[model samples]
Target chain A: AAGVIQSPRHLIKEKRETATLKCYPIPRHDTVYWYQQGPGQDPQFLISFYEKMQSDKGSIPDRFSAQQFSDYHSELNMSSLELGDSALYFCASANQGLYNEQFFGPGTRLTVL
Target chain B: DQQVKQNSPSLSVQEGRISILNCDYTNSMFDYFLWYKKYPAEGPTFLISISSIKDKNEDGRFTVFLNKSAKHLSLHIVPSQPGDSAVYFCAATVYNQGGKLIFGQGTELSVKP
Candidate 1:
């Protein structure tokens, strides 16, 4: 079974730079979610989209924004990156239903210097 | 204000034994719960999930027991195998919220042969 896919499995950036992370959700999956996991911490919800529309938001920083494209793919854009932004970024997708069990991607490791 | 928590940081079990991982939550509005197994540098793999209306859900060797009154949930893996060693995360979310998951700190399970 094909799983969610993320681009640039590993990314390195400097402070005040900009970075963009892309996600290709599983086929037929209409909902996408983004999360950040810092060192020694659990995954934190960043934002989510459903049917190419912004559906919910979480603790995502003001410098970060995301949107789902017409093809059900999503991208997370981070500007003016800070060292604190270094972490593992994950993308998950699910078919909206009663259960809504999400399938996750391998994750992108972002290291900000 | 961590809404979800996994008190145990790690657990070791001999092969063929049962592995029990626990999780707790402080949010009453959370209507859905899930268990995920994750390996290093990979995304979380969904194990099992139980809705708030049910007390138990079983899938093969993995079973999830939910206690709504106590706001707690547990995952039991019977006949544990060495291949089952990984970090297990407990997650929850509110229904109709675009399926944004709130995850616990995770518990590492080591099944030794």
Candidate 2:
């Protein structure tokens, strides 16, 4: 079965730079979620979208923004990046249902220098 | 505040034995819970899940038990094998509410042969 896909499996950036991460959810899946896992820390919820519309928000920083396109794919844009932004960014997708099981992608490892 | 917590950081189990991982949550609004297994450098893979209305859910050698009253859940793996050594995470979310999952810190399980 096709799984979620994320671009730039690994990224390196400098302080105050801008970066954009893209995600292609499983075919026909309508929900997309973003999470960040820092070194030695649990994955933290960032934001989510349902059917190309913003649905819920979590601990996402002000410098970060995300949107789901009409194709059901999503993108996370980060500006003025800080060293603390370094972490593993994951994207997950699921079909909206009563007991939905999310499928995750390989994840993008961001290293801010 | 940490809503979901896995008190045990790591556990070592002998082959052919049983491995049990526990999780606790403070939010009562979460209606769906799931367990995911993850290997290094890979995204989380769906293992099993239980809804608030169900107390137990089983799949093959993996079983998940939920106690709504105590806001706790556990995952059991019977006849464990060395291949089961990895990190397991407990996650929860409100049904039909954007599907943003809140994850626990995770427990590392080592199954020795």
Stretches of candidate 2 exceeding 4 Å from the true structure: none
Weakest lDDT window of 10 consecutive positions for candidate 2 chain B: B93-102
Could you estimate the TM-score for every candidate?
0.98, 0.97
lDDT of 2 by residue, A1-113 (tens): 89999998999999999999999999999989999999888888899898898888999999999999999999999999999999999999998773359999999999999
Question: How would you encode candidate 1's per-residue C-alpha lDDT over A12-100 as one tens digit per residue?
Answer: 99999999999999999999999999988889999989899988899999999999999999999999999999999999999878334
Clashes of 1: 0
Off by over 4 Å in 1: none
**Best model number under DockQ:** 1
Per-residue lDDT over B2-84 for candidate 2, one digit per residue giving the tens place of the 0 to 100 score: 89999999999999999999999999888889899999878899999888899999999999999889998999999899999
Best by lDDT: 1
**TM-score of candidate 2 to 2 decimals:** 0.97
